[model samples]
Target: MKLIKTEDAVGHVLCHDMTQIIKGVTKDAIFRKGHVVTEADIPVLLSIGKDHLYVWEKEEGMIHENDGAEILCSICKGDHIERGNVKEGKIDLFAECDGLFKVNIELLNKINYLGEMMIATRNGNFPVKRGDKLAGTRIIPLIIEEEKMENAKAIVGDEKILEVKPFIHKKVGIVTTGNEVFYGRIEDQFTPVILNKLKEYSTELVEHVILNDDHEKITEAIVNLINKGADFVICTGGMSVDPDDKTPLAIKNTGAEIITYGAPVLPGAMFLLSYFNGDIPVVGLPGCVMYSKRTIFDLMLPRLMAGERITYEEISKLGHGGLCLSCDICTFPNCGFGKGM
Candidate 1:
């Protein structure tokens, strides 16, 4: 691009977006990049204090900001993702469907390390609704070396830098364990909480079983739910170390591989995650989930619904940013709870 006086740029192409700010009203692009500067736009440019402007200049071995941003988009774009038209050298990405959003942090950092280029994304491994902004790609300069953009693509290779794993329909089963609830001595509150949570997903209440702290009976109930086409099973209560607490043992008896018997998160330290027959999830929930506004269950539920396997290493990392502030007005998922390092 070439820098020239705004008055003489009438026929030239704008190399970048011109931002027009209105105090407390609006601030947005008035003239987008690639716009052909006409006679009528000179006064508007001058009003914004633009005495000089950069005009597009075709050159070999160099790419404009919009083109560079497009390459960055190619590097990061993945399944179920959408990209907005480039503006001011930036391209914004969004989710095309409600699903699990993931970011390859390593790849993102590597690309950003390349000077004059950037990719900013929302923290990943969280559920996002359709049309949620996923990420943005931009170039710092009006133009960049073609070699630099090529290097960025090479870093990503074939793998996407961001992905939206679509959520699938699930048949959820609930097993409420505790002698008080099983014997009807106390109201069964856990099932109501579970049902409310399931309302956010495409799930059906396939089964609901109440059982005493007897590990054998709990195990039978869980296996029976899965055998009857339940893709996900959750056992509430009996997760702590009191001898009578037997939900963990019951989950073990079901032959599901336990991901973690305890997590580093608050309001859910005694959480248990497991998978039966290599794919079906069988979770053991602590009592906190029945009342807490947000817990580890909230963090892991979307991933499980998207069919992503949980690992012990991943659960251990929850120690960072795992404590919930428990505000009077809870804005979960949007808050820092369970957003680990």
Candidate 2:
């Protein structure tokens, strides 16, 4: 290889892969193939302080090692991820598995700033090997900071985190207790509505009981359902402050610890959540729950199926964003009202 002057090297692009420049100029002032350069060449190339340096090459799907998708997948678990076009430090992800997993949002930020990103799935806390299938990420776009990716790496070391909850076939018992619905006054629409929602998840109605607004009878029905091994018990109607409303008292009589007798949410503020000694979850649903699009039932049912333990503090925090207006379009799926679950 021959040496060339810095001026001669100005307009010439790399003809071949170049590495380890020897840094000298020949009297002929022309660089030949394989002629190396040194620190003196740094002044001419104008490349410095970048987290990444690369030779410009045109190739399809060549992503940076610090890409956001790769970083997110490394921390998140599951397979079947869809890739999206890279742009401005953000990537979309969708989970194919129906389970519970934690996301390290802080690590996502670092990949965003690193100029390129890749998405991968959590391979039990160690670095994921090449060609491992990642969870589908195309549906949910995740954004992160470019510099925070390194910090995300350090925190992800060898921790066997629970990525998703195993699917549990839930057996639910529905108790429709209301004077209006029990008699020939009105049709029992609440039962059908609750059944339709439960059908969306993996569940079966183990028992369905229609009782009047009598606390003793309602309590007996609940106890009977528990004895039948019902995982969840839902009591519909009679959740108001009216004298005839006795669902709350009935649930309390079953020796269940009432988590919250009322929630901050609208259209379902009269909702109640309680847990019996066997850890069976019992929900006291209000009348509006039947007709309202957004209610406490809508918020809690998903978490219940996901096997999350409902706490009073978490239910209390729902007040701020839980109010769902009956919009004409009914955009419940996109809305974040109960997404905290």
Candidate 3:
């Protein structure tokens, strides 16, 4: 590329998009890249403070900004991810279906650390609806060495840098354990919360049972649901360490592999997760999930529905952004309640 005075650039092509900003009115590119500058266009270009401009001049080893952005988009494009057109040396990506979005943070960091380009996205490991914006790729300059983009591709190797796994339909069962709720002293409010959350996903409530804090009964209920072809089972209440809290013991008696009994997150420290026969998930939700607008359950539900296994290592990382601010107007899933750096 070469810089020339705007007046003598009548026949030259613009190397980059020229943006004209008018506060909230508009902030769009008035002169797009590769547009041949005409005599009539000089005055308007000058009005936007374009005294001089860099005109496109093809070089053998260098690539244009838009081309670099295309490479970045290619790295991020995966199943259920849609790519947008290059605009102002950037490309935006969107979700093609409702699913859990994931980022290959290791490769992403290596590419970012190489400099000259960037891929910005919403927090991963969360639910994203169809047409939701997933990521945007931007090149820092109007031109860069083609080798740099090639290096990024090499770093990413055979795998895409990001992914969106569509949520799988799940057959669910609920075990509501608590003496008060079982005896009808208090309403079964916890079941309503679970049901309401279920409305967000593709889930069928195949089984539901209300019982006192009995380990044997809770264990029997969980196994029965699994035998009935439940994709997963949720046990609510009786998760604390109190003497009467037998839910944890019941889950153990069922012989399900317990991934973790507690998480390092607020409002969800007593949560438990296990898998029966190595596949069907069984979870014990703390009482906080019944009342809190967002908790560990909300953070992990999308992944669970998508059939992603949650390891103890993954749960241990939630401490960074697990504290919900409980804002007056809570915009959950959009907020950083479970997105750790």
Candidate 4:
């Protein structure tokens, strides 16, 4: 690219988009790239404080910013992700379905460290809706070294840096274990809370059983649901250390592989996660989830619905940002809780 005085150039092509920023009014590209500058366009260019403008010029080892942006987009695009038109040397990626968003952090970091290129994305392992912006990629300069973009692609290799795994329709079952609610002595609020959360993923609640804090009964209920083709089982209450809390023991007695008995996250430290016969996951939710709008359950549910087999190590990483601020108006997923886990 070559730079020429705006007033002296009337027939040259613009190499980059010229943005116009007005306080509280507008910030957008007024003159797009490759627009042939006319005599009357000089005054408008000067108004935007453009003393000199960049014009397209072929340079053998360098790439135009527009092409560089496309290369960056290609590296990040994966299943259920859509790309937007390039603007100002940037491309935005959107989700094509409501599902879990994932980022290959290692490759993302390597690509950013290579310099002059960047891919900014939303936090991974969270739910996103169709048409939501998942990520954006851009080249720093109007023109960049082709070798730099090549290095970025090499860092990503065959793996996509960004992906949106569509959530699968799972048949869920709930077993609320509390003597007060089982006998109808008190209203059962846990079932409604669990149902509402499942509704967000389009999951169907296949069966629900209310039983007292009896390990044998809980175990039997879980087995019955699984045998009936329930995708997974959820046992609420009785997950704590109290004598009456036997949900954890019930899940253990069912011979499910316990991935974790407790999490580092607040509002869900007593949570239990296990796999039944190495397939169906059985979750034991604490009482906090019934009251708190967001918890460890919200963080891990998307991953589970996306068919991910989470490991204990991954759950252990939740300690870093597991404490919720409990803002007056809870805006979960957008909050800092359970980030980078």
Candidate 2 lDDT at 132 equals 33
Global lDDT of model 3: 0.90
Instruction: Give the distance in Å from residue 128's predicted Cα in candidate 4 to where it truly belongs.
Output: 0.6
Per-residue lDDT of candidate 2, residues 195-275 (tens digit): 888876789888999999999999999999989989899999888999988999999999999999998887788889998
**Considering only N, C-alpha and C atoms within 3 Å, which residue pairs clash in candidate 4?**
none
Residue 297 lDDT in candidate 1: 91
RMSD of each: 3.9, 11.7, 4.1, 4.2
Clashing residue pairs in candidate 1 are none
Model 1 clashes, total count:
0
TM-score, candidate number 4:
0.87
Clashing pairs in 3: none
Off by over 4 Å in 4: 1-54
Top model number, TM-score? 1
Candidate lDDT scores, in order, read 0.91, 0.63, 0.90, 0.89
lDDT per residue for candidate 4 within 1-341, as digits (tens), equals 68999997787769778998889999998898866689999998999899999997767998777789999999999999999998768999999989899998988898898888888988998889999998888888877999888888787788898889999889998999989898889899988998998878867787999999889999999999999888888989888899888899999999999999999999899999999989798999999999998888998888989988999999999999999989999877777899858
TM-score preference between candidates 2 and 4, better one: 4
1-341 in candidate 3: lDDT tens per residue?
79999998987779878999988899899988866789999998998899999998768988877778899899878898998888767999999999999988888888889899998888888888899998888998777899999999999878998889999999999999999999999999999999999999999988899999989999999999888989899999999999999999999999999999999898799999998888888999999999988888988788899998889998988899878888999987677788783
| TM-score, one value per model | 0.88, 0.65, 0.87, 0.87
Instruction: Give a tens-digit lDDT track for model 1, residues 35-120.
Output: 77899999999998899999988679987777888899998999999999986679999999999999999999999999899999
Count of backbone collisions in candidate 2: 36
